[model samples]
Target chain A: MPEPMGFFTDTTVCIGCKACEVACKEWNQLPAENGGIRELSGDSYDNTRRLDGIHWRHVRFIEQFKGPYDGRWLMMSDVCKHCVQAGCLEVCPTGAIIRTEFDTVVIQSDVCNGCRACIAACPFGVIDINPVSGTAQKCTLCYDRLKVGLEPACSKACPTDSIQFGSIVELRTRAQKRVDQLKSQGVKAELYGADPNGALGGLNSFYLLVDQPEVYGLPRNPQLPTRNLAKSSSFSLASAAVLGVLALVGLRKRRMDDMGGPGAGGSN
Target chain B: MSDTFFSGAPHWAWLIILYFFVGGIAGGACFLAAVVDWFGGPEDRPVVRTGYSVAAWGAILSGALLTIDLGRPLRFWHMLFQSANVPALMFKGWSPISFGAWAILVFGLFAVLSALGGMAEEGRLHNPALRAVGGAVRGGLAKVVGGVAGLLGVFIAGYTGILLSVTNRPIWADSPWLGALFVASGASTGAAALILLAPGRGATEQSLARLSAFDTKALVVELLVLVLFVASLGSVNRVWIGFWGLVLLVGVVGLGIVAPLRLHLQRRPLASAAKLVLLGGFLLRVATILASEGIERYRVAAGM
Candidate 1:
């Protein structure tokens, strides 16, 4: 397997230019959203709403303006985390989704029956059905590019150096240093999904956020779907056991009723 | 997009919901047939036969509904075999859908065999060779096949709920009682279905009374489990407090459980009660699935 590669997106440096989104669509041959017809959302300049099947990379424009220029407009370029413990890969019944040699997850389109089990299992809400393909799809973290020793299109197109792509080890070191620098400047900067010991086993594509994770539509603590499986199955077993005993008791009661009464066998 | 950040529900609409209902009956009927064949009197043969027939046909319908629900129906076989690698069957124990696919296939085999055996016992098979095979299934080997199939049936009934519970969907993942609730409901619905179908097949008044007795107990258990399932949801229970909750309370609880129990106690017609029970079972699945889907939509609309 190749060295584990990933993306470290620093929201502080992101210009919200949407260059990464355009680069991803162009390189991936992804169809334009709503047939390329742009509509003013009135929320901000962000017409492209969220990351989905067609929109692999989305630039969120969070307008936190008080009066005029008091508060800051936070911008975060969201993409698939390519989580170390991917819920989508885990719940896929067809084995269509696989972890690539680069340690990034990829869905084999030809094999996907589009059951959409992965979509519900995903805590990140990353996977969705591609209308044209009729199969669940999301960012592959540029699996095609990584195969030939190339960086991902989104990262390559990012002119601000906000979206850094490199070996996981090197990126973590750089991210920590940046976090320290920002903290010294009192920016309240922190790294999300950088710790390898975290709940989702840490994400390959992590983020550097200035505020709470929820402000950017990210879960504070995402979990795998299988976390509740054992408990659910246990309760099911107990219920089945109770029902079995009830069946035997019902049968016993019927025999007694038949033996004692004169018109017991007559149907109602 | 939603407040939960979920892109959308899995698009598991009517087809999947129908499968859950049919699959429950198939599993429950097979289990009842096995129990009757093993423990009940010989006079219960008609009930056993009807149970096996329901199990056989219900299993087939369940399989069909599941396959047709897939986005690519032609690739339904991918659930069993790994399409990326030919000839090698795929099995993931951690994945409920993987385990469920295999369970359905195996349970279908047993259900069909039992139904054929019951048919042969009634002298329905014309061919001597086919009759002989059916006789073997119904003869000494009957207990073995029914026993295994009964257990698998229970698994199928409960596994469907477990399938929903292991998702990020709001109400689905919030509580562990979905599987328990489904199992109880499966029993009640299974008994109701047999009660409806048994009389036409020459079921004895004694056998019908026995089934009615069983159905009553199952309904009580179902009612109890339904309460526990809702109560366990905590704040997630808010998602079902409106129209969906009303359906669950009135349609499922009052009409489905209470009405059926009242009719049975008052010595009213069993068929009417059975029909109501079946309706209630379908409504339960509808309420659970749509409410979760609606919650996801509500979250997105509310915005973070």
Candidate 2:
């Protein structure tokens, strides 16, 4: 049908104003944590710690300051990656998590039994249980808004245009250009989850980061759950075979012991 | 970012853990029953019946526990069928849970059939029609049904560990030995269960003793596999540094594996050893699941 759409987050220019997060919550009708009560995280200006069930968008504030001036602050708005080969979608037994026509992963709350398979499967720590819906919840990349030709609320509210949403192809070209521009300006700019051939088959919602992926709570080499499937199953089968042989050995040994002493199996 | 938690907890809690425990035993017991039915003499029928009985009930309980643990328990059928596309079977070869759900379901079917056969052979079924069904299963079809059930049982016993290993969790994904370890533990616990329950149902002392011997070996194998599993974790094995570690050491290793071994060697009552093994099996699931879920809590406590 239609071309796939996604987000290209330029973290280098994020102001950490959290306008995008507020807009996302407002548009999604998501409730505030602890019933609108506020608590300090003691980490930075960020109180919303990370993306979870309620918070579809999290603005992470990282301070790499020696005297608050020598180093720089790295602010990132983290959300679900919506990978091309999404771990959550791959492991969702209920078929609740589906890839929309936009190629963005969305969890169908009605269909989700909330078994939490997606929670364990997601490498980026994106999916979590919503207390209200009692289902695994995460960013849908504003599927409703996209269906109506409107942009996602978070990107729409991003005054600095840090979180840009558009067709995947156009976004990739723009991201590469931005990376080149930043590199020319003496910045160590790198594109994460942008290459179609890369990890998780390249995240539909990718990012441009100045630091290592781990520095942004992202995996350097994120793997699908299938990576361990064959090895684990093979080892399990071997163990089963050993158990079977030992069981037979136990039976034969007992038979021999009985035959040596009284009578074979007591003959009762 | 390194300070942050890498993933969300499944909140599997007690229900899923209990399911793992019972599901393992069900699969193990079914396989053990198949072994006895094929190898043991006519006198060992009681033990085989006991195995089938345990398998059937264990599979049923595992299913119930898994269903109740879901967010929408009524929608548990969604696991087996695509609710969006009615009547379309939901099966994901790549998803362990999907495979597990189908395996448990199919295994339950086989377990129930075998148990029915055992019951009819024991002359417990009164209805003529039911007896005929059970008699046919027990007579001509017993070997084939038992073989298939036993194979599926082994899969069921080990797949839970594989399920964990396939996840992004710290200690779970770190090891490939969980499946082996879980299977070994399942065998031991299943044997222990039969040893405890088979008596007075007509199990001979010889058969019981042989099962005990098998259980002892299974415990040793489980112990070795567990060591490898923990070792495979490398520094991530530190997840067992606190309360969970104590459970693993005292409950799983000392009481579950070692004490039972000691009892078996001393020729003490099989019941005593069996109880200890059962307790250990339960605790193993608890320690493995909760420890990973509480990894973040432990990390903070250790100043990590």
| TM-score on 0 to 1 scale for chain A of candidate 2 | 0.95
Per-candidate DockQ vs. reference: 0.57, 0.55
As a whole number from 0 to 100, the lDDT of residue B39 in candidate 1 is 75
Among all windows of ten consecutive residues in candidate 2 chain B, which has the lowest summed lDDT? B295-304
Tens-digit lDDT track for model 1 on B119-169? 888898888887887888966688788778888989988999999988877
Model 2: CA > 4 A from native: A68-71, A253-268, B1-5, B127-132, B296-304
lDDT of 2 by residue, B1-304 (tens): 2212376677878888999999888888888988888877788889888888899999999999999888888999999999989899999997889999999999998888888899898899998887887888865488778778888889899999999988887777878888998899889989988988899688988788778888988999999999889888877766778999999999999999999999988989889999999999999999999988875422231134
Cα displacement (angstroms), candidate 2, residue A220, comes to 1.3
Cand. 2 TM to true fold = 0.94
Top DockQ hit: 1
TM-score of each: 0.94, 0.94
Report the poorest 10 consecutive residues by lDDT, candidate 1 chain A.
Answer: A259-268
Per-prediction backbone clash count: 2, 0
